[model samples]
Target chain A: MTNTSQDRILEVKTLWHYYGNTPALRGIDLEARRGEFVTLLGPSGSGKSTLLRILAGLELPTDVNVMTLDGQDVSNIPANRRNVSTVFQHYGLFPHLNVRENVEYGLRARKVPAADRRERALKMLEQVQLSDFAERPIARLSGGQKQRVAIARSLVLEPVILLLDEPLGALDEKLRIDMQVELLELQRRLEMTFIYVTHSQEEALTMSDRILLMNDGDIVQTGTPEDMFDRPNSRFSASFMGVENLFDAKVVAVSDAGLTVEVNGASIEGVWTGASLPSVGETICCGFRSERVQIADDSTTSMNSLEGKLTSHIYKGKYLDLTYQTALGPIRMRSWQSHAAPTETARIAWHKDQTILCPKS
Target chain B: MFRPPTHVAPASYMSFVLIWGLVALLPTAGLLLWSTLTMENFQIVWEPSLQAYRDVLSSGRWQVTIRTLEIAAIVTLIEILLAVPFALWLAKGTKSAGVRTVSLALLTIPFFLSLSSRTIVWRGVLGLNGPINAALLQLGIIQEPLDWLLFSQFSVILGLIGPYFPTMVFPLYLAFMLIDDEVLAASKDLGASPAFTFWNVIVPLGLPGLGAGIVFTFVPMIGDPVVPELLGGGNVVVLSASVQSLLRILNYTVASALSVLMLVILVAMISLVAAITARFAKGGL
Candidate 1:
């Protein structure tokens, strides 16, 4: 995917916001570039939505200075003066207007001339592929149709930026997937700057050019999806992504090759390449995803192998989920169901790089 | 519903409907018949004539109808114009609940207060030597107490506005609140100014409330007697007072005829306005 230009379309410098005496956002210095699809991926209460509201000018920041839209100072500008459009999950279509009227609403407001408004609205409705239903009352529309009309309404305005707050949260799984594909296509075609917010990790990975993973009102990491998945920087990211097994281990030795760690009275060796690597006797947390652990066959296994009793086995579509009681406590592993039958004793092993270590609190 | 076999019948439902219809229509029919009968001996009253209708359509009685329409139209126009700005302020103002509650109190306190008491209070405030006149004098803004403030068309209008302004405001406020925040954002993002947003998005969205407010405030004002009787003195005679005079004198025929005329005019006004509003609304009434 093409990245947005480094020249910022909007910038915030040390922005702060509060509701009454409670702070919702504190010293948030964020920027959005032109034509970028940046997803603010966070759990709720992480200030992602609040940040979007501030950017849209719906809520005033308590203390901040900011520039927006080609370096124009928009710190004190009201919502109506800012060049940003927002689409909410509710799809907020005016019930009293027809689809065409709703689409033309912004154009008429800007005094784009009556003749031109009609033409532009028609063109926009066609873009969303709702041209046949332009004259239908909004109340008569289905949920997806209403969403399409709302998108058309926002798009017809030709805003500098579009902020979508969980736009597909209300849709069913099938419809949500369809809308996500359509939205990505529209974003590419229009070259509009998009700031999408969602708590769904799948949506963040699929739609964002860059994901800003937020937690507790702070961005934990901002990087590509591959970087986030293959090399998570924090325990929170690792756990949130999919790591199912974690254990506190003590580093016994480190060399240019690898490090040996002790966990649950068992010595395990792992690659130690992180910048925050610990010294001898320092405590660290080791993690591995459920899918990465596998049953070790003594006939073919070479390194980092363990012998254990099979506690339970679950037959998943493509793999068998096996729980084993190992010297390092209970560890979960996934093996192809076709290759393995449930045996009381099973040997398990994984590569050293598959085991990740983080500084233990 | 599909027709059943001869075992079940429809007599019971039809009988119930007939009974309810008779119960509703009987009083209106009785009133119409009795009003048309000329009074003689109690049981022998008969021979209806055009005399009652003539009296109602006479110059002396017709002026009250005209006067009532004039006052209602003026009040409706003023209320709608004033309420639009106030509604916009309420909808787009500070989101602080305390501020909103206080502003709403300003509208509802008088709205719920006794209409008579509010009129009496205004009567005192707008008196020749009342608080308003005294303040103007004390501020050296005027040397004379303004006679236009009391016992004139203005005071009557003021009294009507004081009691009925919230009717205009609450609906318009609701309409404005119903507008989506995204619509306003979209307008701004497209380079719309504040004034343009108000004219195009805010006004069109709130038009239903405006139309309803005008009908609710103006329609009742036409038949209301309290404001004119207290503040208007003999300056204005609305249709309700005319109906009252005929009723008091036992001229039920003329009273009924005058009511019918007013009802017809009110219905026409409502229909005309509704048609116009429905045309522009695009999707709904």
Candidate 2:
């Protein structure tokens, strides 16, 4: 919740990384406050995991202007000397060590006394609810238990920041949800900074206090979950965030309220969500969520109404997805209510407040 | 549709085990039985006796047995020390595929040659007039050709090392290759230094292969008749040489007794290695 620089625990500036000749991270700047759960959400081949590795000191960046952890410069420190831990995607626990020894490894490296190390390791294992499994071999553990042991191993080190690279990506759906809640609870309880990298947007939206959406080696947008879902600033962000309807439109009139754009010879009203206002006669993209559309019976007075024929209906258990072929395109709507049969002519209307207009690129 | 046989018949299984036991265990049992009988007047005595065992101690053949064990143990230790780091580098250090392939091919090439032929090349390299002495003389490190470099314990041990090095390396290479890079990265990320990671993670995970390498190198070095014969220059007599001389004199009972002693020592050494490795790596390997 604290977003100011005074409470910043980790800060990175101008970080660049290249794998051979291909640039993976391009001059990215990142800042996280104390106890902030910041999620880097991106698809595969995005620079999210690379950025996390550099922050954890497991990787050396091609160039970095400055990096600090807890106000201490950590740009040159290696992973072992740095006070940061990482939970690998496959839960890379040592196969030779038992559960307790695996957790005690970091303490042993730091030369903690035997009695104190055992006590601390057992206490951390108890926190992860794996105290009974202290003597168990790593091969005997299930997937979820291995995940918990991986977490316990990192947490026992008491690092400044914990970097998780798709830690729950290996779990099944039910267990994944369970671990998501458990992870959030653990982070809140310990008040530790967690930098999680995941490609699942729903997981990011559900867990993060701030989300940095990355694409093509750059973070295109950074905002809260609601802001990201409601008002995406680019065409990529809108499509990545599950906005179903998008149209290419040219602005005809600009007013204080919003802009009126001409879409397929029909004048549509939408609010501008970009940083700068677009002048009249400028081309841009407009998008809206499928759930925001409604079947309007009296469409003659509405400002953003489209007349179309219902082409298909998909039953999705919790909701129905209705596709309508209008002059603009095939517009899809997610409706919770049962609608008219297919081939019925209907008018769909969306409020201007629910509309989002951004740059075409 | 054709389906493979799921289970073999019980009679066939028993017969298969019987055939293996006959081909393997019967000869060892015969040697043990023969060691207990003594020769009388150039003919075999039916009476069993411990005279051959007593003669082994009195004739000082036991010293040769101990010397064989000592040299084998030293050479095995040296091989382990050299092979581990080389195997580790080959498995995880270099990123070049060509280097790995070339090194593996080199290690495997010696396997195709006979041990005598492979070891003969080292004599040419370590002899007084060999390239090693030539190089040392040319570099001004030695005034004369070093006689100790050939036909000594050093030369015998050196010859044994080259022939058995691949045996030590191949198993270790396999074990180190199977170690996940992520596990090593996790170790570093968990605040362990490089040295700590090598001792705690790399060594324990590589124990099975280390055990196999030790057995493969040590067992054969004890009974090898070529290296000590060719390089020891008739001064270093081992158990195999004593057994050969005893057989030439028709001392079959004492020869069998010495062979049984060697077998006992080998079993004990292998078992000790297995116990230590098993203790260090529980539920692993």
Candidate 3:
């Protein structure tokens, strides 16, 4: 195995890939430093997985734009030449081979000496805690065990970086959670760069150092999970970040007092900081995270409190999601540890910063 | 919860199976008992004779068995080496779907062609003034028509190879199809080239069918009388034809004994083949 030089592991520039004229990835620019866990998060058909395939050299971009690893141009390099390993949604374990042979397969392909391959493969089997089942068949292992074996098989080469394409998507919910934690722990222990691709928001939020939010074959936004969640830059981002209270409104006026927007017979005002302030009668929409909106308290300070009837409530262990029918239309809010006035109408308010503004088309 | 009625009652199934089993066993059981017992007309019937068995061992019947086995072994080896590559190509190569369908049709055409018609065609094709000789002569590849093309071991083998290629190819193809493309991609992503992937990943997965195909083609070739009868002429008398001669001469006892001997040899060959295949097919779940 080669030593990991502390250099940029991969850099993709303006990558555009297409499938028979249908755009799969458009103008994707990304860079992975030597050892970072970057997860590509998006909905289905968001080009996240396509981007991973491009980076792994399994796919070629429509244009031969520069893609480099450790400063070496590898845009057209075959997957075998790149020292990157990928774990697929299906484990793709060779059904015919036992665990030990499957793990040793890559080493043999690399033309490692027989003695070295055995040594390295046995060590890898031990690392994945499958030493006891080294001789056991791959098909006999449970889902989690098969995935671990797949990881061990890929990791045996000590790959420069590992690409995981929805590796935990096939597992049940409890197992998926367990695997997420396990994978994060493994990545931390190995200190190897992991480029994970998934469409699950919770998965991205749970385990990404930084997430690339992709939409419609492009990277819509890229930020740390907290940044993307707490301050999503657009309506799409807000929705993707699990912000539920998004509404279309028109800006009625902006003054030193504050900015006011008229919506559904209710006028809501908040401090505005958007670069392009909407003119009067200009259509705009705003969003807020369900948790950011709360039941009005006596100590709270806000000029934007709305009197709304409590329409529906669903209790979660930590928080209850409440639907409030105010004059501004139904607004969803999340409350922690308590429910207020579910029987009839109530007032809900939030700080100015909690409100997000976006241009409405 | 209501239970569904069992259509095949256990008693009926057992009785059915036992009847078929007895039907199959009766002839073999009869042969075994006849081979062991003294006949009422001892001189004419059984004669309590181990003589046929002795004749089998002494009259170069053992040599014929060896020759039959050797020829089948060589044929199986050659068939596998040639057929496997084509099978793999047919199964995994990026040929157009129409081409694949057509080529598969070509492989299967010989199976439906009458055996007698195929042999007659081979005779003409391989004849001295046949198309092959004429083509070779016109191309200046040969000065004389090759008389050795017909009525030889080579011709018999050519005949065997023609009919048996599909048998060999079909199983290997099925096995190759069973290999998941993800597994192939995973191997590639793990830094294996196409060649390495085929040997380490594809071949192991496809072995059981490869083994099965070899067994299917080999076992029958050992006892096939037609190939030798039409193509071997007087130059070759494989074991099956020799057994036929015994039957023709009204040596039913000897023919039966010869068939039983052939059966024993076939069982041994099958077991050997099974053992080899079982070694590779383990853990293929």
Candidate 4:
């Protein structure tokens, strides 16, 4: 999101970071408008966390040409000096202090008046719905409560941006869902920039206005969840977003009408889902989500269809996770368990535009 | 523990910890009893009199008591103030354990040598013909060798610092090590300067250990004979030396009373300081 009248809340140009001699983050350029909930989505060691730390000024970047906050340069500022706060994993709530005192820590550090600090801390505690536990020692709070206190503490400082490093990672399944809802609500209400770091694809998809997928210290793709899952730009992005069926195919022809690709010996016509179609004879990775394919009777199946023997199938409540041995390779698909009986030759079909084609990883 | 550690037997370990204390403390209890007894006229009779207590109170042993308190208070204060920062550096400055071990070993090298040898070394270092005087003379920083460096209150204070400084460091280092680095980093992230972090986080967190160090240094220093006897060299007469000299002349009654009084005062002073520290900490940071 951008506005002509307002400057970017945070802007980074050509950022690089290294741990010792090994590069943790390769050159990265990024800009965030005010109130954008950007998710840094990647697996472990993918440099997502490192990038977030650099943005928060917790770690110094190896080199940065333009690191600014609200159009002001903040390259040399420390974490304490920068107008950003973080809700670190494990909560990082000071155990020796009560909830109220812990919430007021930043205010106290800035030498805010005693009365103002206490009143503000109380107000923040109430906002997090922990007013009753203001005087309670942090050790006594439950995991979810601790997380809320941490969020409240970070927000009370009124930072320009808040970085959350898997804040709900420690919670149980039920609590995580609840916190996810609460956090998204908070992010919307606060109207401040948020850089959320998480490896959970579901979390990244659910909360992010835009997801920046990272791999091997490089950002692979940046798009909305729909764009990522439906039409990924790279094989890494496609597979990382949970594509179960991938096949190597050579393009036979490309036109405005559609593109045809030859897989093994079968020519499959599929609408080109990517922005630019591939040239004839070029090899590309064809990926499809398991749930996107449709299994049909061989007699009525149309284009983008393949005939294969059913290898195996797994009953997974709402859908049957089935694999078929086709001429190209074994391809997996999610079929409703009620329609599938284990032993039969089957025809699997999908729409022309459902094929996600990308360059090889 | 998820699984109990097999090697340690709580029964045996607890007895070793508790039984030794009992065995050591029986003598003090006996001394307290003996302090109330006196030999009447020429007869060896069990007659409890306030005479020895009165003599202890009247013979100006209170001066020795006050002097012992002054020295203990000064030594404990300086040792803690110095040791906490050094211990913090050892525990947090570097991630390497080897550095801490080597530094601690170097700090306590004086303890490896006998106390007498260490005291003798201090004497040499601070003496008129000592290395310090020679260096100063050679550099022409002073025309005369400093006389008060050795055999003065200064020497007593200086002498106790080196040997007892480690006592403060050991406990404080343990406490600081117990603090999670995340907690400290979080403090700094929340805009606390280093000094504020130390006061608001490190001090309260490390207080119990520091309080123990204070006991370790102060309790012993209050009645310490070696420092006042050897290093002080008659320029200072602390309570311990007073107790020793009283015994030398067969003044057993007065000696016993003096020892008991010093013990009581030391315990009371330690308790008072502990109470103050506890109150000031307000449970924790």
Candidate 5:
């Protein structure tokens, strides 16, 4: 968390909120500098949506927390009065309003002159490429068009921070991907700080400048996409960041070579990058990506090679998805090309850097 | 929850239509037949005559028809104005199932007791020496008990509204409850005040219920003669009251004519309501 400084557009500290007796956000500390696209990434029930609602002033937060926008404390400001907007997951398009009217709502609320409001709304419509369908009723518009209208509605307001609560979650995977690119482009072009909440880990990795990964009402990690994907600090963080090859390994020793972790009576050394590496005789998790695993040389003296029996190979066009069965567990790898059939001997290796070490949960 | 209909025999469909015809259409035909009959020189006549129609259409009877419609329209308007806000509160204010069920039970208590008893209760409440006058007297709001409170048009309206308002309330509550909380929240989030949201979102959403409630309360108020009989004190003459008085004096032909006229007016008003509802519904209001 950062203080309310000159460059920061929004600052939050020690924010605790509750729904009845249930804690929705516990000790949340976050800051968004000017034009920063921060993502609140978490699974369902992790309170990411709750946090977004509180930030948007839709839900009054319950706590002695400090929240500021542009160096002014706005913790108690009502949603309409606050200089913030939101795009709900369903787009929250008014079914009675046409696309133009929906986009013109905020400006009208702010008492903008009718002529200027109409011109600006039309310009915003053109910006979102919805000018051609401006008069279409919301019920007649497709889902993607509604989404663009929602975006245009908020962008026309030019709020300090736009809180998006999984606005693209309702779209299909293909459309969702396309919208992700469009959203990132819109964010960059407008230079607006967007505090977007979503459970999709890939979306956070692809779109965010800084991702605040949350779990069970607690922020687990906050980092850039690569910082989180490459240097996840815990078992939950590693798996949530899309590293799937986590395994229980007992620490045998730590030395100049690396930390030696014994897995199923096989000693495999891994490079530990975290501060205060685990001591000897402690159990921790070792993880690596499926794409990082390769066929081991089988004769190398490195401490990262393991032999297993091939269970199956799925042809994925660009990559061969192989599952190898070993005494430890199933080790999956996505090789560039198919090697052999299932139920065959296989040896796989990953570099020391790719072999991730995480605390056992 | 519904299974696909494998097949419905044509015989069953024909029976359904036949049953509908027997239940709904036969009575209208009967009314049409009765309205044209003649009462010749104080004796029943089989010949079709326009005398009953002429008697009913006389200027004297027009007063009764207009008064009947006015009272029903007033009651329906008052009920609508009262029921919508009450229904909104009942649906949205309390989330407890027990409270909603108890409130609904309380609303239905007027239905169980006879309409005549309900008129008696209103008489007690609106009478000169009743609780209303007593409270007003004790509060120094009035020096004497109000004279026009009981046995008047006000008492008749009060009597009918007690038993009929729930019909308006229940359906309107269902309509208000159908609006998702998110929709209202979205309206507020879009910079609409609570009053604006109620006018723009809640009223538009509840239009069908408004139409339904109007039909529910209006038809019975216009048709019922008991309330006016007990509360009118011979001062008010509604169409139904006129029809009742006409029938008691062996004016069966005139009575049937008045009844037919009331039925036609009700059907016309209902058609108008249906037209307005259909138009707004099509507009997606």
Candidate 6:
């Protein structure tokens, strides 16, 4: 299902925010389609949380050209007047209100009748599998249950957009993975636009339909998780997505297939993955994922190969991480195959298509 | 395994409890006993009787007790209404640390001054020819100086509010400060207006402080002799003033009876507040 303008639930244009003189976001544009799970993936202070807060109307941007929610201009609306709700990182449920009462608060604020409020709150609690916990105090809840209640409290309002500010950050690893699945399912069933902000790349890859990779107050790349993982467009994006074998190279030759780059007197062939290809003699960065490398045997006839001395091997449960000292620097590889005894000298080979070129900066 | 040393030993704990009982509880128990005795021929009669309490009822001293409670309740309510928003502003609304520190220092200044010294200043302000009446007359609001301005129950209540206001504000400030900012943001994000958030989230979460403010302001206000003496100008008699008059006549039994009655009223009020707070703690406001 391709999303067009008619499907866009939230649109922000030319938004900028500053804390006094320090800018947090520098004139960024964002859009989310109906029922789409868009993750703002970035490190702390990358403006992801600031963008979410602006969307939820909890924080006003320093300047904005346009902001629309569900086809209406909401640039001037306060948080309480907007049709957006945020699930805070700490699951800021009211300690003075019980589970169901916390859920009913938004409805009550909107002046919904008492009977309808209770019924709707109970229904939302049941959807989160917390029907039995409706009367329990917030202090009595576990971390995961509190997260569900936070989500339920926001969803009970039936807002146009739901903003989640690292809502699962406090949970343990297993529970966090489980909650990610639950949240994805919940968003799918509700058909509500979800704007989730998190710093974990794996979480973005696992849960997002589209990911916006942010760095240094700007969104450096936006694409599907697979596209972001395989075809990062910048040095920042490449390293952020776990591409460990990155080297500075000078382009020596360009062809229809790819470009040949020289790194430390070694000619390496890498695909031109960017929108525009650099001409010969331009300096650039080349990278490839460690899992894409393979140990080349004597019988193998791969032209793209590197010979280096074995440095170290770490035995991970699922894969072996091997590092080699090469002319270009240390090249790391993750191998899933059961390898033979380590040799001092080894040949590591990768396909040209697996190589990615990024801007050196 | 290494164990942390205990802070209080068993013997010390017992002795501390004993000392507290001897210092605090013994006097109240003695007063309770004294209230049940009778006085005759200007001598102490050790026989237990309810004649002192009976005399208090017949002599119309019970009216003073009821009136004192009414004034205390009214002043506590007024302080609550005034202090909650001010405390909220001091704790959460204001952004400047300097402003918060200055405001807190201002609230605490009254505690450093004597109660009589602070209360005596109000007499000059509330008197018939005081600036308040002069300003009212100058503004064409009143035709003549209002004689009932200083020496009435109104002035007594007015005088009591300023001395006890800091008590109400301090606890509320602490409570409001402890509330997390994200909880408030979540409330607004969930579509609660500012007013709704105040009543639903801020007030309910501030119950412990509200209960404390009420007890701190109300209990002391009921027994305040200085404000009534200075502002009431001996025109309005409350329980404390009545107890003093009974003592002056060497009626220790009746004085102790009045003190015991005041204690009963205060305990009943505090218990009601504690019960309400406990219920809300389990459920919600």
Q: Looking at every candidate separately, what fraction of the true A–B Cα contacts under 8 Å does it contain?
A: 0.53, 0.76, 0.83, 0.56, 0.29, 0.88
- In order, what DockQ does each candidate have? 0.37, 0.60, 0.56, 0.53, 0.41, 0.69
Write one digit per residue (lDDT tens) for candidate 6, span A62-155: 9999999989999888899999899999999898888999999999989999999999999999999999999998999999999999999999
Per prediction, the TM-score for chain B is: 0.81, 0.91, 0.85, 0.86, 0.89, 0.94
lDDT of 5 by residue, A91-185 (tens): 87766667887788777767789899899999999999998998888889878888999889888888888889899989998999999999999
User: What's model 5's lDDT at B269?
Assistant: 91
Which residue pairs come into collision in candidate 4? none
Interface residue Cα RMSD of candidate 1 after superposition? 3.6
Most accurate candidate by DockQ: 6
Give per-residue CA lDDT, model 1, range B71-142, as digits (tens): 888888888888888887888776778887899998887657667777877778899979999999999999
- Candidate ranking (DockQ, best to worst): 6, 2, 3, 4, 5, 1
DockQ of 6: 0.69
Q: Write the per-residue lDDT of candidate 1 for residues A1-361, one digit (tens) a residue.
A: 3435446787788888888888787777777778789898888898999888888777778988664665787888766667788887787676667899888877766667988999999999999999999999888988788888878888887778898988999888999999999999999999889999999988988888888887766677788877666566667877766677788888988887777899988888776535666789988777777777776656442356678888888888788888999898888887766466778887778877777766543
| Model 1 alpha-carbon drift over 4 Å, by segment | A1-14, A29-35, A57-84, A157-160, A190-192, A257-260, A269-275, A280-283, A299-345, A359-361, B1-50, B87-94, B97-113, B138-144, B283-285
- Give lDDT tens digits, candidate 3, residues A1-361: 2334445688888888888889898888887876688989999999888888877788878875778887788888878888888998898998878899889888888889989998899999898788899888887999999999999999999888899999999999999999999999999899898999998989998999889999999888788888777767667877888878888878888787567887776777764535566688887777777787776776455636788888898988777888998877788888886554454777888776667766652
Candidate 1: global Cα-lDDT?
Answer: 0.79
Candidate 6 local Cα displacement, residue A127, angstroms: 2.4
Task: Flag regions of model 6 displaced more than 4 Å.
Answer: A298-304, A337-341, B1-12
Q: Model 2, B209-257: lDDT tens per residue?
A: 9999999889988889999998888878888899999999999999999
Q: Chain A TM-scores, one per candidate?
A: 0.89, 0.96, 0.91, 0.95, 0.94, 0.96
Model 4, docking class: medium
Q: What are the models' TM-scores?
A: 0.84, 0.93, 0.87, 0.89, 0.89, 0.92
Report every candidate's CA lDDT.
Answer: 0.79, 0.90, 0.81, 0.84, 0.83, 0.90
Predicted structure 6: lDDT = 0.90
Model 3 stretches with alpha carbons more than 4 Å out: A1-7, A251-285, A298-303, A315-319, A337-341, A359-361, B1-13, B31-44, B60-64, B95-112, B233-235, B283-285
> How accurately is candidate 5 docked according to DockQ?
0.41
